[model samples]
Target: MVAAVTGLGLGLAALGPGLAPGFVLSYDMVFVPDPAFTRMTFGLTGVVPRHVPSDAFVTALAAVIPADVVQKLVLLAVFVMACTSAASLVPSRRLLPRLATGVCYAWNPFVAERLLLGQWALLLGYAALPWVVAAAPRAHEPGGTRRLARALLPAAIGGFAALTVSALTAVTVALATRGERRPRVVRVVVTAGVLSLPWLVPGLLRPAGVPGDGTAVGLFAARADTPFGTLGSLLALGGVWNGETVPRSYGAPVTATIWLLVVVVALAAYWRWGQERRGAVIAAMVGFVVASLGAVSPGGLEAVIDLWPGFAVLRDGQQYVAPLAVVVAVGLGLAADRAAEARWPGVAAAAMAVPVFLLPTLAWGAAGDLRAVQYPDDWARARHIIDGDPAQGDVLVLPWASYRSYSWNHGRRVLDPLPRYLHRRVIVDDAVTVDGTTVAPEDPRAVRLAPAARTGAPPAVTLRDEGVRYVVVDAEPGTIRPSGAATAVLRGADLVVYRIDGAAEATGDQVPVAPVAAAWAVASLFVFWSFVAPRTTLSIPLLGSIKPRDPHRRRTP
Candidate 1:
């Protein structure tokens, strides 16, 4: 029954509107920003974007569906993930102690808010994490080889699954969680090696690691310097801390209460179960904090440069939260499970666990509502402009308002977060440092700055003299409004598109030539084997011995 539900979750999610069971958001891989993965997948299947780690996967998947259709399907998948993760508590009903476990998963803000519409593979991979951890040996046994294999078999499979969503997360979690159980050192290493094989094999054959001209690394490395000790860390954990500066968004009175409920429940569970599961809880918390801080860590720049110089890696601090969210959710689930197993009635314990699952749904729904007000017209208007230009070539977008939204409206290519190898697009989205030092909207220090683009900077008559072909502004008039040498071509309430008469056109696109046929075929085979048929052998028993425990399973208070 439990297995059935698990399989059902996976199957149902996959069968949903998009046929892809991942997070749903307006961020499209193609069209809007730069053609990166979006174009490679939609335009020519023969060519793949070099920089984005998941280009092949997203492209192959997107090829089956039109880009516009994929966006809507992705939206449905996002909702399904939310509903399924939140409702995954049913099968554990008899195992009341473990009932709260599902709530820890379903109610998690990170799981609901971000995973619902953002990174799909991570969501699927994360769903498998708790089961894998719970199945791990608490101590070494004589059936050492078998036990070790048992543990790593699942870990490898789960890690590989995560790699498809975000390779870095897969690597981090695989490395961090290694040797946590009985330290069959050899087995641990082997497991990690195998788990990483899917990606490593393809990566080795590829000429470079992640694609891009390597300029993005400057922005990626700047995220490590955020100050450690501060109350502000909580909000920032979800990239939502800037209430005063960025304006409070993704919050609602009802959803806020649910978020509060989960926090309170987590605290309660922590207090209740601290005596026994403290180490696991602490480790999970550390991962969560580190990943969150790493995203905005300014201090990380020099460290990343020192450690991984030349490679435009580690630009995504938020990416760390992917697996960390799983660890923390698992920890919370375990904590909640332990608390429920105590003297409290199963009903009462379940009551406590219920909110953690619901908070995510409400919080995200609220966030969507909030974002609706902030960027409502932007999507439609952006779509209209992109549609107006029917050319198949790349189109530049300013102020970057949800690439997926624009892609849906206009089939044109864009240079979003992920850079394309085929349609090499110049992107200006830099990272925000820990101290909040980012390339300002109109900083003159940048070689690419133009006067109209620099209105956010000091009033410089010199800036207008610089050549800037297009200007997209979401701000109000007189704030950063265009003036000399630029004419407003299209204007919505807040969004305005301007054209520069004499500015030179930006350099042409730089698309990556496809890998050699043999290499591409081999890479595809490895991905298939790694993700599809990862498990070659199954334990003879197929199920573990049911070690019944005392209802009160702890020695500590």
Candidate 2:
């Protein structure tokens, strides 16, 4: 039954034939190879430490699977997991209710908008939320020794599932727990913190003192910036900051319908299961309040960003809706079960189709815009040229922009692809700031090169000083004019490569490996093993005799 539902969910998600091999969704999800780029480095550890288990996981996967295939697989995995995780949380004996829950969570406007916006990391984190919730230690549970381990397990798992969500999950657990179990919540929080050292330690060691802005507050808010939209879009679980990404087909009418249905069902669930489900009700309310506050948060989200260390990373407050989505999915499932019991099975089944009918535009590669295309042959040739060089000094990429408007990439917004494509270290000036706060690429070399790259002029002497050997200019017409110092080595339809004169002799500080990085790596491995060890023991032959305790077992009074 689980397998069938999982398969159905996957089919529904991949509604379009275009969502196949070589079909990339969005640019943010593009996997690039960088052996030196750890989660710490990628998160700008020197600026702020953030635990990014997903980065580590993806980087590790890229090592084994072909990078492009890895990209497709990651998207597929997210969709499948989103469905299955939500399904698992339904707590209903009826398969239809579970299936309904899965579809509702998986096919909603929130998933579609985030997928289109290329916030795969956020989605990945969102996908893991249900599982984290499932693993959470329940209130008033006994068996202290075993319960402590159970609590720790979810925290460790959440640590890998995006730090922002992990922190929120911890808070939710804390709020839900009371009495003796409250102490267990502390253990979970601490365990999660300790395991998150890979990103956390770096963030703590080098905090980015970036200030918050009111503009960011409004931009990342949960209210969909559309006409006559209230909490309707937020209830439908959309409210993406970039309103342009919201499908035009999902206009006010559809939004209103979804909101009404959600309210009716939620009211039914509350009336039917009131006080018994108080914890869940409170969680949903808290989640909605927090999500609704994007940027202009009265709860001091902007103040928190400025005052709190490692808080700036969570500028998008709408992401708080993720937990609310889980609550809604579970509520719908419970409501469906109740309807089935009351001889309204047909009505319950019809409710299952609500997300599909309302979010029709979200199916099949987000209205056919997410299909992947193969990289140009010139990219491969350029890779070959860069790989052949023994010195492997930094290569500079031009049309100097952080986010590239790649015509070949279906004109979707994407990070600069050069760094990922090149074999050698390539310097592409793509420093980004949130509001007025500088996030990264604030390196002196990148700062110096940004202007020259924009002008199509090579700061040749500065490049030499920075140990930059080769310059690869994307042959975009009217974007890059050949610098006087650049001697074109390879010119193709797509790219032009230049060997910088006297670059081989030029030297500078090699990219330093932080000592804490190695420690974090070791700690991350241990945490990962801890999460998986018990499961492995149960499944494997020799260790099968261990008889792992049921994680869901409830303590009696």
> Which segments of model 2 are wrong by more than 4 Å?
1-4, 15-18, 23-25, 32-52, 139-161, 204-215, 223-231, 267-277, 298-300, 431-444, 475-478, 504-514, 528-557
Candidate 2 lDDT over 76-171, as tens digits, reads 666777777777876678888887778777777778787776767667666766765655544223333233334343334334335556556645
**Worst ten in a row by lDDT for model 2:** 537-546
Give the per-residue lDDT of model 1 (tens digit) for 181-291: 424333334434444443444343333332322233334321211232222233223432222111123344455455445555555654464443343334344445544
lDDT of 2 at 140: 22
lDDT of each: 0.38, 0.61
**Mind sharing the TM-score for model 2?**
0.82
- Model 1 TM-score? 0.51
Q: In candidate 2, list every pair of residues with a backbone clash.
A: 16-364, 23-372, 24-372, 49-203, 217-295
Candidate 1 residue runs with Cα over 4 Å from true position: 1-69, 72-99, 112-289, 292-301, 306-328, 331-343, 346-364, 367-394, 398-436, 440-511, 516-521, 531-557
